[model samples]
Target: MRLRRTVLPSPDLLDIALAFGSFGLFTLPVLIRGSGHSPTAAIVVLGLAATVPLSVRRRAPVPVLATVSLVLVGAALADVGFTVFHSNAGPALGIAVLTVADRLPRAVSLRASVAAVGLVTVAEVTAMQVHPATGQNAIQLVLAVPAWLVGYAFHTRRQAERRLRSETQERAREAERRVRAEERVRVSADVHDIVSHTLSMIAVRSGVARMVLEQRPEEALAALSAIETASRGALDELRAVLQSLRDAPGDPLRTAGALAAGPAVERPTLAHLRSLVGNLRDDGYPITLALSEKAGAPPPVEESAYRVVQEALTNVVRHAGRVATSVEVAGDPEGLSISVLNAAPAGGSPGAGPGSGHGLTGMRDRVALYEGTVAAGPCPDGGYAVRVHFPARPVNRTAPADRAEGKRRG
Candidate 1:
C-alpha cells in the first residue's frame, strides 16, 4: 500500500535503480570470485519481490501488505539484502496508513501501525542477530520505521487542508447568494414606496384639476403644472430606486425604507374618492362610486381602498379607452373589498398589453403593503377586473383635517 501511494514517476524509476543497486551488491561476490560464485538468481528473485506488490497496493491494501511482508521474510531467510525487497515496503505501509486513516476502524489503524513498527523492529533485530559479525549498529538499521511515520504525517496534513479549503469556498458562495437575495428585497420595497406614493399624488392632482377647470381656469392650469412637477419627481425617484435595486445587497445591515419624505402631509381618504372620480368622468369616461362602510376609523385602510379604486379606473380609461369606469368599495370592522371593472379598451393599452406592464404589478404591491391582496385579470364577461381586499382597522376619519390639508397640488 505504501509503495503504490508513493509510486510517483520520478521516484518509482529509482526502484529500477534499487534493483540494479541490489544486483551490483550481489555481483560483488562474483567479482571477488572472478569466475566462481554467481548470485544473479538470488538478486533476480529479490528484485521481483521488491516491485511486484506495488501494482495492486491501492486496490487491495491488506493483500499487498501481506505479499510484501511474505517477500521480506523470504529475502531475510535466504540471507539476502533486505533493501532489495524494501522497494515495495514503503508504499504498502503508506496505503495501510491511508486505509487506517479512512475506511478501516480507528482501533484497527492503531493496531496496524503498532504491528508495523513492531515488525520493522523484529526485521532489523534479526538482520543484526543473523549477521552480528558484520558489526552494523541497530540504530542505523531501525531508521525505516521513522521514515514511514513521517510520510504518514504528511498525507494526513494534506487531506486536512483540502477539506478546509473546500468548506471555506462553499461558505463564501452561500454568503454571496444571501446578499443578492437581500438586495432584491430592498430594491422592491423602494420601488413600491416611490411608485405608489407618486401615483397617488397624480390621481389627487388630477381631481384638483377637474374641480377648478370650470370655476378657476387659471388655478386648473396651476394644478396641471404641479401635476407635471409631481410626475417628474416620480420619474427621477424611480431612476434612483431602480439603481439601488441593481446594487449588491446590504452587507453589514439591511437597507431601511425610503428615506423620510421630510415633514409628511395627511394621506388621502374616501372623501377624496369623489374628486378622483369626478376628474376622470369630466375628462371623458363616466365614473361612479359606491361603498359599504360609512364609518371613518381606518385612515391607511381608506387610503388603500381609494387607491385601489383609483388604479383600477385609471387602467380602465387607459385600456378600455372611453369605456365607463365604475368602482365598488365595501368595508366592515373585519375587512374591506374594492373592485373596479371596465370594458375592453377601444384600442388603447391598460398601461399594459403593450408598452409596459409594471403598472398593475405596482398596484398589487401597494395593496399588499396594507396586508391586502389584489387580483387583476381579464373579466370573464369582457374587459379587465381589478379586485383588492384590506384587513380592517378601527374606522378613523380625519377628513375635516385631511381636507384642510388636502393637496391642492392636484
Candidate 2:
C-alpha cells in the first residue's frame, strides 16, 4: 500500500488563516485578563473589522488596506487603540501593500503605497500622541517599504518572463508560415512541370497522327498510342501529388502527408531519362542523352536533373524545328551537372512553344534551394543550351529525407 503525499494549502489560504489567528490571539488575551474571557461588543467589533478585510487582500488590496486602517483609527477614538493594533492587524496591512506593489504598474503602485502609508501613520500618531520618529512607529514604517520593494522585484521578473514567452510563440508562428508558403510554391511548380511537359508531348503527337491518318495509317496508329501513354502517366503522377495534400494538411514532417494514402507511385529519377528520351524520339525529335557513369546521387539532384531534361526536350519539340539535341549529365561528390544543347534554330526562328515563362523560373527557384545554379542561352556556335549544377546535397539548408515530398509540401 502506497501513501499519498499530503498537499499543502496555497499561500493565499495560509495568509487568510494567519490574519484571523492573529486577531483571535490579541483579543483572547485581553478578554481573559480584563473581562474574564467575555469581551464587550466594541472590542469584538474592532477585532472583526481588522481581520475580515484581509480575506480579500489580494483581489482588493487598496480597499482592504483602507478599511483596516480606518477601523484601527476608530478603535483608537473609542480608547481601545492600544489593543486594537496588537491583534497583528499591521502584518495584514503589510501583506496588502505588497500585493498592491506586485500587481499594479510602478507609477500607480507608488501613489497607492504613499496613500496607504500616510493613512496608517496618521492613525497611529493620533492614537499614541507621539512624534513621527521612534519605537513601534519607526519599525512599522521601515518594514512596509522593504515588503513593497520585494513585491516590485517579483513583479519585474514576472513581466520579463511573460514578454519572453510571447516572443517565442511569435517566432514559432512565423516559421510555420514560412514553411507553408514554401510548400505551396513547390506544389504549384510540380503541377506546372508535370502537366506542361506531358500535355505538350501529347499535343504534338496527336497532330502528327492526324496529318498521317490517310497516307500512313500504321504510323498514325503508333503516334496515337504514344499520346495515350503520356496522358495516362501524367494523370497518375498528378493524382499521387494531390492525394498527399488532401490526406494531412498540418503534418510538419517533410513526407508527412505525401503518399500516405496513395498507391506506391515511383518518383521520376535519372534512370527514367531513357524512357523520357525514347518517347520524344518516337515523336520525331533528333535527341541524344549522355549520362555519367556515376551510379547514384542525392534525390533532390536526381529529380531536378530529370525535370530539366524533360522541359528542355519539350521546348525542342515545340520550337527547335528538327534541330539535333543532346543531354549531358555528370557529377562527383561535390555536385551534379547537366546541360541540354540544341542545334541553332532553323530559318532564324527560336523554338517557339506554348509555354508559361514559369518553367524556367521554377527550375531556377528549385536549383537555388540547393545552392545550385542554372544558365540558359544561345551558345557561341549558334545553338541553344540549358545548363544546371546542383550541390550533391543541400547546403545552408537541412536536406529532406524524400526529395519527391517537395512535389506535394516542399
- Leading candidate by TM-score: 2
Q: Which pairs clash in the backbone of model 2?
A: 319-351
RMSD of 1: 15.8
Q: Write the per-residue lDDT of candidate 2 for residues 93-192, one digit (tens) a residue.
A: 5666777888889888878887877766666666455422212232445657988898789889999999999999999899767656655655676687
Clashes of 2: 1
lDDT (C-alpha) at residue 338 in model 1:
78
The list of candidate 1 runs beyond 4 A from truth reads 1-38, 52-64, 82-109, 116-141, 221-410
Give the poorly placed runs of model 2, Cα more than 4 Å off. 1-54, 71-90, 130-135, 247-264, 293-301, 353-356, 392-410
- Per residue, candidate 1 scores C-alpha lDDT tens digits across 156-194 of 677789899999999989866754554454346445545
For all the candidates, what are their Cα RMSDs to the real structure?
15.8, 5.3
Q: Residue-pair clashes per candidate, as listed?
A: 22, 1
